[model samples]
Target: MKQQSSRTEEPHLSNVENPSRPVNSARNDVFPSSTPDNSSGESATKSSKSLWTNLKFVRLFMAYALATFGDWFDALAIQIMVAYRWGADPLIIALIPVCMAVPGILFGSVAGALADRLHKVRIMILCDGITIALTVGILFAPSPAWLLPLLALRAMMSVFHVPAQQALTRQIVAEEQLFQASSLNGFVNQCAKIAGPLLGAVVLAFFSPQICILINASARLLSGAVLWPLRRLVEKKEALVTDEHNEENQKEPETFFKQWQQGWKYLRHTHTVRNTIVFGCLGLMSILMVEYQFTTLFREIKPGNESMLGWLGSSVGAGAVFIILLLNRLPRLGYGWGLGGGYFLIGAGIAGLGWVGPDTSTAWIIMLGLCTGLGNGLFMVTMNYLLQKETSPDYVGRVFGIQNSLYSVVLVAAPLAGGAIIRSAGPSPTFQMIGLATLAIGLTGILFQRMLWSLNRRSTSSEKVGSAQQGVS
Candidate 1:
């Protein structure tokens, strides 16, 4: 809704608010220095109209949406092949996620460091091209045993693809548009959740699961095609930032090993990155550990094994979509507050769920699902925006790579821990404890916000001092 600006051209460095702002310098990732919404309703409406019309952003976003859609179908297709075609037990079925997560755990940060050393647009296009071959190779996987390795290989490609995509988005979209653009992308993810599975179900009825694999392969092709133009558009931002950084240091690009090590070094110094990994990741972990308990809770309350999980899951998606829409209509909420608000809302929803009982009305339960979804939508949009805005383009790849690896770790471990706890201590206490811990993390955001404020002040002062030393002041 903040769309009323008149500029229609793709992003240029002149669009940056401060001409002398330090290139690739650390700033506030949690509390962005940008202003809040002051646009009139008419201006906001105009901005909305121009949002998707910006051709550079449109092309980049389209590539992402297609990849996401195809990825969903791939998940469905693999399950069908193993479960229905090969008669796999549930244990074998579970290995699919393990395969996907393993690549992220093993290679996520390394892939990100590699992305920074290459042209991000080329990285994306190359990865997609590889994905097409990998998806096709799945058709020939002689047995379920072979599927794991193939899937792991494909996921490794994607681990590289994600950071490149994130870096490319930053280089393509204007700074002011970062939050809105990310919000729109989040909508695409939520929509794909609803549409992808439905489309897979419909297609499977009419054709073999191989048909779905073929569609996924095609999606990867098209995603690459849409990105071809970005090779030029992204260079604009890279050239802008690299000129300053390159001039300050008169050496070849840091050796790959140094770049990789430097990424870890940056993570150590950057408290904002540390905060999210510690607090944000933990909050998400808490929910994942307790989330499946819903199925158990419902089973105890109802006579038949009929679960409201499908319906409740839909409610969560709907809630997420609703909040994303609402946020897009408003001007940028203060991003630092957005982080705090997102965590608080999510923790609140999870905590509330602990109190749900058999007597709770279906409507009330649906509302709680929506609540968590709202928090998730906000958290994701803010996290992506923060990474791009705060980190130098040189380092964002590694930052996101680090995040992906940590998230995958939680994805694999949290559920296993939850299952163990539920078997011993029971679901009720586990949910209550995890939910409360998440809520406490949310409250800690305020103190972290103040700490980040001081960090930003110190960073800004250091930049000025450095410029003076270089005779640029």
Candidate 2:
């Protein structure tokens, strides 16, 4: 149980679910979305069916999910090998996220801008291919020191992959189905969370961590293959979009540095993107501050239970899947409620996890896991939808890049501080402290929601007023 918990860590980390860059540091599979203002006009009965009909998106999702399938194992293997096999300390465990985050700080914005300037599908494919080599490199990593650098490189590639994947998602899915598409992607990640760990646990019981790492590498290789057809589809689609625009409609090319600056500018001027980034980063920082320490608690919970980490993660995934089902049923769930409520539940779950000890029953721990999962489903979906909906398709890649960069900046410090806290105060107290902080951050989001809503109201009113004025003139 003294092992660090990677299940939560995996969401933001490169190998896990996806979103906001791995260190996903906060979200997973945010691969991007398209939008129509609302889905009200759509046939209610076939809400999800409409999305399934898009064979291209389905194919991309399956391949991305396949790549994501492998994500669960790499960190689990590394954490187990580091904390259990290598007998590393909390500080060593802290380095895992730090390495993952550094790439974001260094390359997140650059990668994002690159995603926009380059062919997105090609960017995604290339990154996926590069990751195969990096993931395999982990197998040969003899120690924590060696494995961390490999994880960082893998993360570096993901910074590029994420924005490209997201931008491509925007183009592939229709406007009205954006939310549905995002929800479905979240579902895929949840399923991976559930299945990846359970399968990994079974594998771990019989084999070495190296075996699991190889399994992850193979998944990526297959994922890259699945995307080959998709690359052609996306390229062809873009060509058609380009053809529709006459010469005058074509965009004048901007220098790469200019495009990168424009992304920063867009993030700064756009309230929605700015606000979401703030919440996403803080929530992520709050979670990472103590996420890696869960392994310490697990050791205390069940001696020699290597699979407890996976089970705990699986429980979270199960909770998320249940919530995802419910959210899909609702035609309209306000972003504010979704985000605010998510923070509260995740905080509550983390706090409850703090209270667990050797005497705590397994059922109660699983229940807490459920709480976090529920919150994750809510927060992650809303975050993705907000970005997809509010962002101009033009700046999607840069917006995510800037956001991931911020995530990396936080990732740099949160784990180190968390490790220090855990080393000093132990896991229980550290969890309790960070959990309350996250709770407060979640509560703060209520105000953010109000401001966001008011901004939308004004924006809408201004548009109507301008239209009326024009008519009168």
Candidate 3:
């Protein structure tokens, strides 16, 4: 007689009974009486209010926002210093980003596994401390060569910091509030993106790069201090259960390589995670292509008007901020609608750029940028929220680690590919090609929505069962 594998058996049983149990259980356990009460509309309002009112959430949110702001601020300062002060060549300047990205490709999965095994809050604080120390090193760096390695080391710290922070968000916030929390986080990031560089520019106008680096280091130090208290909160909540889970995890005695492979295995088997990752990759590639061509496109439309490019960039940021704020106010939309619709809009907007030429109005060009940005903002928030929702707590860090590696690869490749296409076929055709490709990815998501949903249902069911078995054992 042939014997069936446990993995194959688990999904079949999961599909047959309690398909929604994992999501439901997460909500019920984390937020007592979180579900709406029939008699009182005010109760739901209060529940939503509680998330903002919670001291732990407020503290973490502020720390994360400050850290992000400092990062962007420091990045611009480095570019200015490298370009003007150090007299770095274009190739040297380019290497800065490449240095940051290489670590993600090499160490992302390993860092994620470590995040899963270690205390998340401590990991975040440790990473922040390292970043602060590295930032201070930049002030003393004698040459561009020295700075590049320090920047790479700083980037490596982020490889650990990001997954740990994300995993910790799951632990601290209620499941029902995850969407809003993620949205707020995205909002803070975008705000930092817009403000940080401007502030850096202002500082550079009056001060040396070293002063800006010092300010950035102080921000990092503040971030660590703010997070220091979170350890007590997390310890109180998960000490007993997490200790048991850790002990069990250690008992199996798996190698680091094997643990890293587990994340890939989970990603390969989980349909929702796989599809979302694909969709995100495609969407990001298309956006990057359009952005890379934007300067050329602007020059074609309005010859020699360099400052207009900044306005165009601002328009995109404004659009993203607008959409994020809108999503925060409205009821949460379904993942299928948000993902599919967002991509469709992004595709249409990017394709519209193909139509712009000398005859196109400046207002029209800005509008296209706004449209693409809005779609991007929608896609980012929805995909992140869904990823958090579908991923089990144990697997969150690993899944996000995989996502980071994939995104880093895309970030490095897309620009090179886009530039090649522009050189070979001109920017207009390249835009059209990227746009159509993005649209096709979105349409595929919409067409296969049912299958993806089914896969998520089965995966969630199996996770619940596995957790139950572990509890019993």
Candidate 4:
């Protein structure tokens, strides 16, 4: 079994034939020209790393953070609008996440491929523009029904926006600093989550939900404005043209099925990519289902569902913010344990929500909310760091696209399932079941860690032994 596993492994940096080459020689062929330097590389590498450290990365980080805030605010506004204004039937309420997920599954491959070929910033700007227009469309629409399709389209735009931004990060940041960049982004995302929901809820207190929607739209526009300045900092690489342009038509167009087939082929062949995608699919499904279901759970616990849902969600967000703040202090933690522990806690907390009194005091629910948030926040940061570090830049966008699509699928499915289960068993048992499932998944992650680590270690050791024997000969 060990030998079979060992044969499938790929080369990582610890397997050097001449360890001194990276230090002694001026030319380092390991990374492409886009990798940032650490003051040790040739002039370009040094310059690249220098750019990575400056205000550009900071600005881009803030831009995305603001955009994410807008996204979440819109989500809160929609839920409030549907529940309070439009009347909340389970199926109708479920349509929100479903709308978001459908486009992602349909458009992921095309969007990912485009991200690789086009300028990432330009693509992001385009998404922002379209989303802003959609927001305006929502503003003019006579009713909630008119807004659903627009929201769905906005979700599709998000699919492209995220991967493009992630790829752009790789273009500017140095390899060693990749983890730092990922952590920073993760922290910012959590901060946005913490602030957006709370702020949106506050806005809902005074203004009509429709006005809040307009503000969310405006925030997207502002986010695009912030990102505009980073266009120069992001160095553009000539795209790898996998398809020849048809001179007569001037379009390199492939059938949708054919494009999807190509994407599957790429994913199926790449082992680590395959694993990452699977992990993301499974993980995201659990996350989306649990949170969406919480809407009903909150309703059962407190008569006023919308307000309770927003407050509980905000509490979870607060827990996430706390986790992000602790990342710097907890650098010694391993990703495997950290992520596993997070999943476990989240599952356990949500399950415990059932045990909280029928009175549903703010104190106990708030505590559980914190646990749920912290666990999810930790898992997001660690898992993302692992995947980004493992995959090569060439396939990052496509792989992430697939992952995002799977995430959307899970998000869509979970709420429907949650609603069904809640209706059947009531909130207590439903919460318990979700909690158990989450804990089991976390346990599975923890149990599988040894296998993955063993494989990584064996590969490293084998390479060292090979180099030693070659040197002796």
Off by over 4 Å in 1: 1-19, 23-49, 232-249, 292-294, 303-307, 446-448, 452-458, 461-473
The C-alpha lDDT values of all candidates are: 0.69, 0.68, 0.70, 0.61
TM-score of 4: 0.77
Which of 3 and 4 is ahead in lDDT?
3
Cα lDDT tens digits, model 2, 193-277, are: 6778768878889999899899888988887887777565433122211122222233555588876876776665555567778
> To one decimal, what is the Cα RMSD in angstroms of model 1 from the true structure?
5.8
Instruction: Point out the higher-scoring one by lDDT: 1 or 2.
Output: 1
What value does the lDDT take at residue 79 in candidate 1? 86
The residue pairs that clash in candidate 3, if any, are: none
In angstroms, what RMSD does candidate 4 have relative to the true structure?
9.4
- Candidate 3: tens digits of C-alpha lDDT, residues 1-473: 00000000010111111222343232211112346544445434544565666566777787888798898889888888899988989889868878888888888888887776677878888999999889999989999879989998999998888887776665555556777777888788777778988888899899888888898899999988987876644321122123356457646766766657766766675667677788787777776766657877767667777776777677777877898899877754656667776787788778888777767777887898788778777777777777766666556678788888887787778777887888898878888888878777777766766665444245453444344335434
Angstrom error at residue 179, model 1 = 0.5
User: Candidate 3: where are CA atoms >4 Å away?
Assistant: 1-20, 23-49, 235-258, 454-457, 461-473
The parts of candidate 2 lying over 4 Å away from their true place are 1-49, 81-93, 142-146, 234-252, 297-311, 357-359, 423-426, 455-473
In model 4, which residue pairs have backbone atoms overlapping below 3 Å?
none
Cα-based RMSD of the predictions, in order?
A: 5.8, 8.7, 8.2, 9.4
Over the stretch 1-473, how does candidate 4's per-residue lDDT look in tens digits? Answer: 00000000001211111222221122111112343343444434334443334465666766776677787787788888788877768667667667877998887776776666567778888888898999888777666678679878888888888777766665545454555566666776776666777788899899888877888788888978977765544344412222232122224454544444445555654444465457555655565555656655666666654566656677777887688567645535554565567788788788888676556677777788888888876777666655554444444566567777666666667767776777888887877877888888777767775543222323222232223222322
Residue lDDT tens for model 1, 256-375: 777677677666655555665666677778777877577765666543635467667777778778887887777446545666667777777777777777677778778878887787
